[model samples]
Target: MPVGAQLLEGGRIRFRLWAPLAERVEVSLEEPGGTVHLPMEAREAGWYELSTDRARVGDLYRYRIDGVGEFPDPASRYNPLGVHGPSQLLDPGQFVWNDRNWRGRPWEEAVLYELHVGAFTPQGTFAAVRGRLDYLRELGVTAIQLLPVAAFAGAHNWGYDGVLPFAPAASYGHPDELKDLIQTAHHKGLMVLLDLACHYFGPEGNYLHLYAPAFFATDATGLAGRSIDAANPVVREFIIHNALYWLAEFHFDGLRLNAALLQEQAGQPDLLEALAHAVREGPGRERHCHLLLGHDRRAARYIHWHDHSVPRRYEAVWNDTAQQAVQEVLIGAGVAAVDRPLERLGACLSRGITAGGPDSLLPSAFVTFLQDHACIGNRALGERLHQLVSPRPLGAMVATTLLAPMPPALFMGEEFAATQPFLYFCDFNPDLIKKIAINRRKSFAHLPGFRTPKARARIPDPTHPATFARCQLDWNSVNHSPHADWLDFYRRLLAVRHRQITTRLAGMHEEAVQFTLPGEHGLSIRWTLGDDSVLTLLGNYGDLPLAGLQRPEGVVLWAEPGEAEHALNQGQLPPWSVVWLLRAAG
Candidate 1:
């Protein structure tokens, strides 16, 4: 180990570089006043290290090899220009926090809002996003899920192609700026969950493969795997260390692990257990507050069907199966099993993945959605939930309120019905850009009745005002007639969740949650607290009117035409609408 390794755990600035190709190495720090240089001592394995008493937390520094100019730290705290530019210094402890009273509400109470930082606001920087924290708080959202911020190839990207796992994208402001955002969110009572992509594949400005072959795993195609395999001790240590670094350095409340199907590999002796153990028992890990949120696709089998295992303990999976199930029924897909199970949708609200059955005829946990960032701008489906469900509010009500067991997530514009599309665009190396274009062309070519690539290239230029305009939340829409009415509908839906459902099920375990989705047009769900209190949530999924329904409880949390009507009438439901009923206290 180099002398710099001695201070790895301390706040003192220390530096190390694996530049086997270089004859000499020097560490340089750029202060607000001037630049300073520190001598590096060589160690075994072509590594160089240095420890300097002058360095502190906010020092902006990089390393120079031989006579070369300074390059950003491979593990930089901030890269304002994505991964292509210089690094910036950030002090994590400088910001004052306000989430002291927050003990992270359980998973049952979580309503997630997933947003891409680059597209979430008119200005993509962390400081710019502080304005919207209050809106999320008011919407009954318990967690705000941000896409990755790791340093990627260029000035703009999705952050999935990130290379520097430790660096915050410079486009999103410096590290301290992020701290301010988190602190601000916490003050407003919103927990922040950052999405982290471990399946690392990026083309430019990344020299990790050149520096260490041991860092990536080889697949059947011999392609380099993105995530660290727990089978490899050193690699596992690297990932665990990275996880710990973010928790301590950034004060993030939780991490949404990307693509759990890839991470939760079989015959791995439960890698997550090892990871949880490392974080729970590792030195100083306890000092920081954090949660490991696994974004898995296999929520049904692991979370409910089977007993507790390494993978089952994850906070939650993405629940795509549930999403799909709801969508299929709403879209009127006549796949025998689903069409026959009129109560299956209702069962979905209670039993979750099981609504699709153990060997689901269709995908359970469809992670169903009317419109998401992925389907945006593809000309494939457009961004309207009504377009997907038809007859408007009927399908909307079933999804928004009646779904059980599974927690639902929404994109930024879904609430008030913003019309802009979230396209998939990125700034990559020139060669990689060519590859992206070709691959996209090939993908569109396979789609029926599609010939031109114009629709595929619809992503707005990130630097343009149009891009920001496309991403901004349409707050004004909330007052615009039908859109405004729809916005109010979402509010009522949320109120139902809080005052009726979430309050009762907050502490209930997985088995206690149950659902029943009946036919293609309606769902009924049952939830019970302890052994005494119980309530049933029912919704009509079709157009026209569903009437003659009895209230399962003494009180109704939400209903069509107002709670005064007690019984749900289809005339009151409108098309694609939802409603909830709660039992009143005697």
Candidate 2:
């Protein structure tokens, strides 16, 4: 509201730009007759403003600074002509929404499936994703957390390099199409959440540095060494309003905020706190708008160490610590613990896996995922967990993550064993693409495969069209034998989770749970559900069977290899198996 073009009642459009570096600015509105350049009034505190009846909705406009050159609106709602092109005036009130009473589902009931809009299907549009809602609902997914769709430079991106914070990408069809996708998901009882970058802009298509150098702080940790100047009230408001714009205008149920600008923003909490506060006061008041943070570490002070006076605190942090711990267990990396995987997993299940390990936080306060965009894309070959690890250990991981008290999320293709690599690919300017490719290989220089130049060169040129194309999902392969089996496994686990676990998750906390790592690769965890009920998990993630383990006292809920009674009667767990049992309360 403070900046950008706003449509006034009476068919008049009010335009505003905050350019302190320039002495004057003009609004260049494209008309059927010709270009109309309107000189804006210089206002106090580096602001320029104009109100004109000449401009209407669907008009192409740009702001020219001191007659130097015209640039797109920094807060443009829709940039159909792409990021480097002119901005289009879009009135959000035009699209009719059908899900007016969609209050949103609870966080505990969430079975999140994170996806990138472009790579989700071959069509790579909002309408295409909307068509798959029925399939997702049948798969037992309650929410779909989309990767960032904010406008970026080229037609393809993972969306972390988004330059326009407010506009939906032109490549993903119209803004109305995106709204329809969300609305359709809402009516299908599936909540749609968006992932957004907060602290930096992409390397290209950003004209802010030329006019508003003050928009950035002198920090080196940003995506392209350009950290957002969050101390500036204008910059802070821009970030806050972007969050509100998506929730209010687009009608997204929640947001997964990734402040990936810096490695250590733990000490500077002002910007994040203020942004969360603004949301808590705004659209958050109307619905179940959950907020999840993704910091460098398993950061949780933002989620757990805050006062909950007005729901200002985040609902959860992306629990990367537990995921990494599970990875380390799969690879046998961690040293000096009672048991292999259970040693690390116990710390997470007991004390919080936060930066400082806060014991007060509940297991549900974190979102645990075995695979996501960052982990898969950042790898040398962008391999999925199924590609990297064995099926049995991977199944053990799936059982632990989904059946645990914490909420679980899955990558787009993880459910059906889609073997396509979710590689790190982007379309930057020609001058920058080569450098990005080189850096992409160099970042993996520590890996054994990338130890030499030739090997690194074989690391898949991220700038190449083939690299991006290689990452698209193979829809035709799902109904095949192995892929269909994997799909059935995911569907079955999620169905059991929804029917049994999610209902008992409300009152679960660290104090009500216990675990015992019996052998080298054995893990036994129990949660004291309310009403005196108890849920137990017995797992063996080793090649050899684990024997002499006590049989859990409850009815069998789920078991890998489908032999819970056989394993229980034998007083042992089969290799690479997990069994869950529930002891109902008296």
Candidate 3:
């Protein structure tokens, strides 16, 4: 076996994998010429390691355990031919990264825009999506949170059911194109975070279990063929290595770990911690990056940091509680009471966890959002915004953006009132599609008008234009009245956030930040920066008029124009409206 240049530098590549059931394991390499096998030495705690004499970039490889079957490398490079194909060798040092000076924005500063690549544009390729970067930038987004773009079964999927963790989806363009997209984003000053699924493999072309038993737990609600469980050191290494590979090779700013709650194991020093440590310490090895956990539980939790800091190791978690709160207000669900249950939403934005205390949630801080791909997906790509705001589109915009303390995330086309539904569709997985449809029906069977069984059926043809069309952002919608108005409101809100909040917190101060609202009718807040400047934010969430909001001595920085906008200033919110004011910067 030829080790090629891999061992020439004298840097030892340690191999560790957890395969408890395997009697023996050997690494297999397939070059353009032929196939080769290298025997592995067993290490303690269910790990197999081998040093190859001839493995280098571009060589396709997998593992053969006890001569049973060929398996893709757990730390694979390219699922290039899709999930069922061989793993291609890739060198982490190849790509030239452009984000040298990028330290990444603080969690408080992030304005995330989540996008599904297939539905984001008509082309459904990484290269094609590059055209929209300027538009996102103009909307004041600091980061782009992409839905999974990993290789899955068939021609299309939402990317969540991706079976191959290493390969960027072939339909979405090749690995180099993905690298180019990241490079473009960095040059345009946008951080790119890939949504990674490490829990369950989607029902298309998944072969993890075929290669090895216990690769996915047989138990219900188990890892679902997508975990390198923490208890297994080799599995842990595989996952951590993949994460490190992305950060080091592609210059990705961070990864949004999907379904973080599922990979549960005790005291084995799991992949999550190892990945974080590697990224933070990668200046000598490669580069530094960030990691954000996407947890399903809305409850909050405390994150211990190396030093006591506002922003710690795990940058920020996703706050689904905020989504529920906004949903309540948007649907006009008993929102009048100021003392109503707000801790779930509040705690989500402030801390990562939902539970704070005895009848409360956790304390971990997180990123907040009003709507997302999942929320839209659950609604069968229906008109959720229209359902909420209806004639009061601007009102909905104000409430969603202004109320969120953690950086707010907006789904693509949400700003322009793109009426196209973000439907849940997957490539030709008949069995999985059937299950999905059935699951949707059972999940929403209790809803009043969801009585039609046919409406619950999954669209069998994922590659059909209709599947992608339903999720497409209707750029033409902007000219229409309500949609245009909504877009304008969002732009104004972004301006307010950047002009006021961004400047005030150029330096961190827990004491300086304050949330103030007088009564349940309206909110009047004054943020004093000691000597720099003061920012006053006023908003009204009710239908009636409000008055007697005392404003301190400062010139009005900016306000929404016209009657309805001014009405918001008086604390009389016209059913979900807000006005932001900034004191003149000295």
Candidate 4:
């Protein structure tokens, strides 16, 4: 049954809930003087509903289970106070929308920029992000993928700890303000992809256990207390409806499902498949709704298992293998360690996979990035790419990612080389705060630096307010010398990608792309499009210039460290540098 407080005609609000455990459910509306309890009629399939004209928009309400304690609506659209407070009635159709004619871009053209609403700006609201839409548009990103904005317990969090899936986080802004951001982004030719975590619910303010125990399955090993029961029909419907609500109501272009592999159910309809089907058959089908699954290499094969005869199952999956391999080569044994850097990096560039390729999947099905939120935030020490590697190597890695064949995503501050660290932070209560801090320290106990008691004490507490404040991007830093130069470098690289590379790779056979190691520490990649045009990339990872390498005959599009003229004149590529060349004819 459809859940939550649905507004009908003539200022009437229909409150419906699925409470199988309760004999009677009543709607408690907060009035001017006190609270008013309205009796609800029980329906089939363990559902209860009530219609009242007095409960209009802006009214605060909750559910009384079997005349017991009151709790916030599980399907709340707005929580004015916080996740634990009363649910406010909101009419989705009331807000004026301007993105009617905005159809999203193709998957191949996507250059994703991931950000958290709180850390994105000092203001930490959806309204604040609207001021930077033009900046992102000028930066040449086609899409902005935001972390979860659902209502949670306290004032600050990474958004993964959301308890109310339907309600936008009150700390971010008003519900209408979120719509304003999405509409504004669409007008600027930027698509919005909301990050959603449906595998498990957060511990704080989680009211599901109070009403619906069947919603979750017992899994002691799961990250959260328990995993969602994907096999349950009610749970499945709730998940599917939430996906549609975001697309149909908020006008978001797509969704990036976090920990997609965890939602798998055996001998039952897959949640991802049902989601893709719902989007394709729904009213937003014309918008080309892209579904990107965040899965590791172990689940890459499942992405291709869906029938190709149907509409495309997913646009792409986050290429963690490629990210880890590249990070190994650049950072080596720094903050986070990686072994076999050369071999892993070589395999990633050669076959589009670090370990092995799923034969049926297309090259575009994988999304690669030089740095991502998890790679920087979840580390033992939260460090940016600039802190991990020198300028030249960082430049080479950034260039390689942008010019790669697969879609590429960028963390918020990477383009300008912002020095702020993106550490993992949450705003749980004091009781859970100490436990979370201890567990976080234990997570990195294997590392030599974090193994000591004194060293472990230096680690930032996830519940500290200062920790969340430190992650905010410093927009002023872009005005400095190297930061300004790096920003320009990203602009040029993305320009070349959007203009020259993306169109050329369309329909090209896999055999046309080739990768070769120029030296023990350098790589060379060349590919020919169907139009006979050739694109080649050369990089030097060592401290010395790579010599005696065959150079492709074409115009030099870009070079690292402003050394294009020097490298093109002399056949030797400089140390820790990369160059992109294009030939009109093979």
Candidate 5:
């Protein structure tokens, strides 16, 4: 709304652009008759705006900066012709919203399932995703979190190389189709979250340097591209407004601000705080607009909990530290190395997984997962956790995270034990593609088998159509042998989670948790929930059966062994097995 084309009350369209250094800016409207170029009047703060009856919704237009050349609107609502093409005038009010009554669910009830739209279904469209809503709902997830859908360069991407922040990717269906999907998802009692590349715009389609160099200022991030100038008020407003647009216009239940922690490292804390304040004052007042940061422990200050046992700023943080520890415990010093993995995992499950200090937040403040896009896709072969670890150990780790006090997320097809590799596929130019492949191989070259160039060559080429296709979920596999059982396993855990643990997640005091190692490779952990219910998780992370553990007293929520009581009472747990229990507060 701050910098895009807005449809006014009288059928006139208002075009606005911030080209601080440009001497002149013109709105090039694609009329049926011919191209109509109108010079915009310069306003304060280097803003150029125009209101014209000639420009209407559905018309394609571009801004011509200083008569040098035409470029797509930076805040385009719909880039139907791709990032290099013109921006379509989309009227936000055109779509009839049916989700007015949907106020959104609490963060405590969140069981996030992260999926990329392009690889979610065969159709790879918003409508196709809508078709899978019932499956997701039945899968027992409380919410669905989509990877970035903003318009990017070619046909396929992991959704991170986004350039047009405002436009939904044309590959994922029309803007209205996405809105329809969100509305439908809300109707199905599922919350929808959009992951945003808030830290920086993608390299290829971005043209901000040409007209507005002030938009980018910092270089503190480890990302390949330059960072957004969070110090600039206008730049801050652009990003904050973009955040608001998705929440207010598209009706997303929440937003995961990707790479936002890097901003704090850049010493631009003002932007994040200002944005949080803006969201809370704006759309957050009307609904449960959960704000999640994609930072690890480094951004602890932003997620620090208040006396009310909730975050002082954002709702939650993506617990990369916890996930790493989980990986370390399951495949200790194997593919990914970490020292004292069981201790690491114990710390994560109890208190210090996130820096383990006085400033450490509540367990519920962390969103834990074993596999996400970055974890699996970044690998040379994109091998999932199932491929690396045995089924039993994998299941134990999954159960531990899902049943833990922290909210849990499942990467797309992880619930079904999907073999499909969530590969790092992108659509950049030939040079950039080569660069990406080289960079990827370089990152993995230090690994055990990938030291040789030949070994590295085995890594799938991201630009290849086959590589991208291989990432697609095999829907039929879910009903087959192990996959069906895996699906059932997830459903059982999630059903127990929302029914027992999730409802009592509030007031989860960080100090109320207890952790102890039952055997050489067993975890014994318990948490006193808000309602004083004692939630417990007992598991064996080793290949051998863990023996001589006291059986926790409570109702069984979920257990790997069929005869759970028999095994627990015997004071032993089978190899790579876990059990969840809930003791009613007396």
Candidate 6:
């Protein structure tokens, strides 16, 4: 039987929970007339089951363990008042879905635009994001990857602190509003990918420890409290079902498994692999479901790992190595201690990573980006790419990232270079808030600028409401002068990617793409398509113009801001610039 509150036929509802520690469990349904308590029948494997016709969709309820105080359901579909409040019954059949024909898109064709609901717009609700769907579509992104919408303790967070994996945050609007957003996105020919943190649950309002202590591994290690015991069958079922629930119920096209390396470290069954298998072979097989593993530098190479023994697979992994390389070159070599900076940057452009070696997957298997939420927001001060470098280099950086062989991910407002700082913001309790603020200041103590007392004071308190408000994007900047130019650059780059490059290189093997460093700061990337036509990209990372460069006898698809016909004809590559060329075979 399925877990949580499930509305059955004839307006009846069935409730179930896996509480090994509880000898007695009861369903406390808060009806309009009065509170109704019903004793649940004990089943095998420490399971509790209850069925009642009085309980219907929209009814508020919570679980009572052995006459203990009421607590939210672990598999709650809706938490109307937040994680600490009672769970609301939500019938999946009640909401109307219009995206019945939505098949979703392939990973290679994906141009991901990641956004946080709270900071994406002033309204900070799923309904508010519907108004911006057209803008994203116009920007040429095929998918919009949302930060976690899971229910958390407070009104605001980065979404990683979510305690209720099954419930969408009530602060972002009702569960149906989220469905509406996904439906609207599919109508606009956009796929929706949700970020999920399976490593650990948030500290606040976490009731898992209270009932099912076996859900957590005793030897697990992490700051986010005890790691979920992936070895437990009940835990595995809970997680696997949650993944399918988002896909089958809410219609999310895919999921980005955040910090997946933690799952691997726990020495348990590969939950990521299970998720991939469930998505592919389970009920979600009808939908084009994709999974992306979010790992740090060490485990990123696992995206290409294929063992006949293991049945699960991931479409791509977040390429932090490529992101760091681009960040280093654009910001300056001193920004990161990268050895062989030119070679590293060239490898990232030609292939996806420098350390992955020849056996590494194709660029399409790696999701590369210059500025993600973590790259910008995780710092003591959330600083954007534009803030770190000048406009010209930033433009070059954008071109380099998009024109690369890999799929590109753009953070919200990255196209327009929004000036707002995406600072770390959360609404934890006062005690946790003080701990977070102190740790944040301590992390930046080694940095030269932040070592000062004044700089330390500038660190925004994560619990402050103003910090979250300040992170909201300034949409008005899109029409402004310099920002408009940035937006146009992104638009044109993506147009070239879709119309010229993507289809030609779609199914080709990884070896078909070649990359070489012509000069210390100049890289030449060439891709040979099956049709015998070739696409080449030339990039110059130096300050002075690169002279004596060989020019390809092909159409100049694009060039740097001020250098186009003149630089190409003269065989002089502009400093900190990128040029795309295509040569047709006779």
Among these predictions, the greatest TM-score belongs to: 5
Best to worst by TM-score, what's the order?
A: 5, 2, 6, 4, 3, 1
Q: How high a TM-score does candidate 4 get?
A: 0.94
CA RMSD of each candidate after superposition = 5.4, 2.7, 4.8, 2.6, 2.2, 2.8
- In terms of lDDT, the poorest run of 10 residues in model 3 is 1-10
Across 290-325, the per-residue lDDT of candidate 2 in tens digits comes to 888884453566676332222337787787667777
| TM-score of every candidate | 0.80, 0.95, 0.82, 0.94, 0.95, 0.94
Model 3 CA lDDT for position 365: 43
Q: For residue 149, what is the lDDT in candidate 2? A: 92
lDDT of 2: 0.82
Q: Candidate 4 on 1-586: residue-level lDDT in tens? A: 1789998988899999888888988999999989999999999888898988988788999999988879999889999999888999998888999888899877767899999999999899999999999999999898999999888889988888787888899999988999999999999999999998766678788877677788877633323545678788888899888888888888888888865434444577777778777888894557768888885665455456243212256777887777887887886753445576655665565456555446335456778888788889877668888987888788888888898777889999899988889999988877788888889888888877888878988889888899999999889988997889989989989998888878776665556667778777878887675467888888887788888777678887778767753774677888888888889964
Q: Write the per-residue lDDT of candidate 5 for residues 126-199, one digit (tens) a residue.
A: 99999999999999887999999999889989887788889999989899999999999999999999998866
> What's the CA error at residue 511 for candidate 1, in Å?
4.2
Predicted structure 4: lDDT: 0.81
User: Judged by lDDT, which candidate is best?
Assistant: 5
lDDT for model 5 comes to: 0.84
Clashing pairs in 5: 352-356
* Runs off by more than 4 Å, candidate 2: 219-225, 260-269, 296-298, 305-312, 333-341
Q: lDDT for every model?
A: 0.57, 0.82, 0.61, 0.81, 0.84, 0.81
lDDT at 281 for candidate 2?
83
Error of 1 at 91 (Å): 3.7
Q: Name the 10 consecutive residues with the lowest summed lDDT in model 2.
A: 333-342
Off by over 4 Å in 4: 219-225, 261-266, 298-311, 334-339, 354-357, 530-532, 562-571
Q: Of 2 and 5, which scores higher on TM-score?
A: 5
Could you tell me how far off, in angstroms, the CA of residue 386 lies in candidate 6 after the best superposition?
Answer: 0.4
